[model samples]
Target: MSVKKISRHSPPNCGARAASASVLALMALLGAAAQAADTYNSDRPGGADHRLLSRYQGSLLYMYGEEALGKADMLFDDKGKPVMRPVEGRISNRMYWGPKKKSPLEVYRNYRHALETAGFKTIYACETKQCEAGAVQDAVQDLPRKVVWKDSDIFVENTFNSANQPGFHYYSGRRTGPDGDTYVSVALAGGYEDEPVFGRVRQFVQIVEPATAELGKVSVDAKAIGGALKRDGRIALYGVKFDTGQAVLRPESTAQLAEMAGALKAAPALKVYIVGHTDNQGELQGNSTLSQKRADAVVAALSSKYGIAPARLLGRGVANLAPLASNDSEAGRAQNRRVELVVR
Candidate 1:
């Protein structure tokens, strides 16, 4: 009798409401977990001390021992040429975005300070109007065209534009690491007072570790060269080195030159077409000119220094026309940027 009196009525669909609330709570938990998975921690590798606005992306261009060109400056000359003083090393490019209410200047300063604390000395730094010159804009636009990987250029451009919002800011620096010298370039923009939507700072960091190997002694002797030539009709040479953005050969190239000279001397009837190749890094015309100059330099060295007849070797710059490997990677680029002796 007491139980029947107590079991009167349900409280206005309370059970349904409780079930709905439980479902909502479960969904909320799932949403939070998904968001956490998408967003990286502030201390993510190669990221600054800021909340990651979104997922982080990176491209390891050149491996530990490969060469990479690091941008030392972002400004341009009065003649309109973007002053890209390139630093060579093992290159890695990384990007991250931070959603914060901080101003552009504040974000720039925070990144700069972090870099300094991490032992990076500023190579170049600029802010606002100083960084918004026509040359800078052109450089930003032309980067995709110049780089071998289009995604990297796109990432850089989008990050730079977003972070630098109303104006622009750029920072580049270097630090000595255990492996080698680590170069860092940071481009910060966003949080412009003029734009309401621009509140996120984007950072593009390029780390270039110095190459570990240099041309040592002449490993490829005359016999080896002759055999390779006899078998392949063409032999690609790697030890022939050059300074970054220059036609001049490094002193380390002496061993390779000597070996090449010895090979020609051993074979009296051997004449080769000295073909120069390069990785796709800059303008096609400029690379063609550079390859030509590099070939000329090699020929000149062989003839004048090693007493090989100039007529026996014809210098030709094919630029990146022929690549032995894919140009998508640093190792491949290193392999492509070589001198080849083709039987004429």
Candidate 2:
């Protein structure tokens, strides 16, 4: 055996370095994927920060004073009633979907965990068999029927129509936050669109903050109203107040009404339409009705109390058809909800 040069070349650390680089590259790719998945629009009213998973797609339909009205169980018909009670400030329903890889139960559990971690006390939770099918359907029906998403119907059919799966989950609870108390409800269902390959979930969130305080001082007086009418042919009145979900004017609205009367009296020849506009909170029909009622109330007040000619003021309610600002935020909604005097 000739002991030929048995010199063994030491193996380079290239393998280890390559493995490490591969892991880092994988991590970077994964990070990028996660970032891409975290692109849900959170520009909702009340709060923007939400504790939702990054993998799920989200759709939101929110109202400032939406009744948390739905069935909590299948015992009896909870129709037109808020089984979980009502939220005074803001109510939002967010729908989500993910691949079938994540089971409905898993999604429910993850949201439950998130709520718990965020100091929310679980008031109610139920699984597939434990949850009543009828109650779930009733609750889904309570959500807005027509939500426009990307210029198309979000819920193509009934909301409960897609939630006809065998395994479903529901949850409801309350939590206190820095601003005020908040309530949350969740529903998770399997097999969306008759397709057993996708999963769907919905979250109904209610944020109840202290009622917005009445403005201490009136921003628009008769002079300002007169100037605006002279220049812009219309003037939006912000000092007018109304009870939530009702056409009844609050007592604090007297000042604005007085100024409106004064403006009318000062300009006897000016005929205007008392147009009532509202934030897009409820159904178009209902909003239209409410706005008409509110406008009528204003007309009645000015005629009865302030002695303004009823013929010069024509009351009309256009509802949310003419919005001054985007209804996605509370401030914008407030701006949109106004009484406008349009010169006729």
Strongest candidate by lDDT: 1
- lDDT value for model 2: 0.64
Query: Please, what are the lDDT tens digits per residue for candidate 1 over residues 175-263?
Result: 86544566666665563342322455555545566553333334576778889988998888878888777999988888888889988
Minimal lDDT window, size 10, model 2: 68-77
- Quantify how close model 2 is to the true structure by its C-alpha RMSD in Å: 15.7
TM-scores for every predicted model: 0.40, 0.41
| Residue 339 in candidate 1, Cα distance off native in Å | 0.6
Cα shift from native, residue 245, model 2 (Å): 1.4
Summarize candidate 2's per-residue lDDT along 95-163 as a digit string, tens digits. Answer: 444443567677778777877887767666777765664455455544435332222233423445544
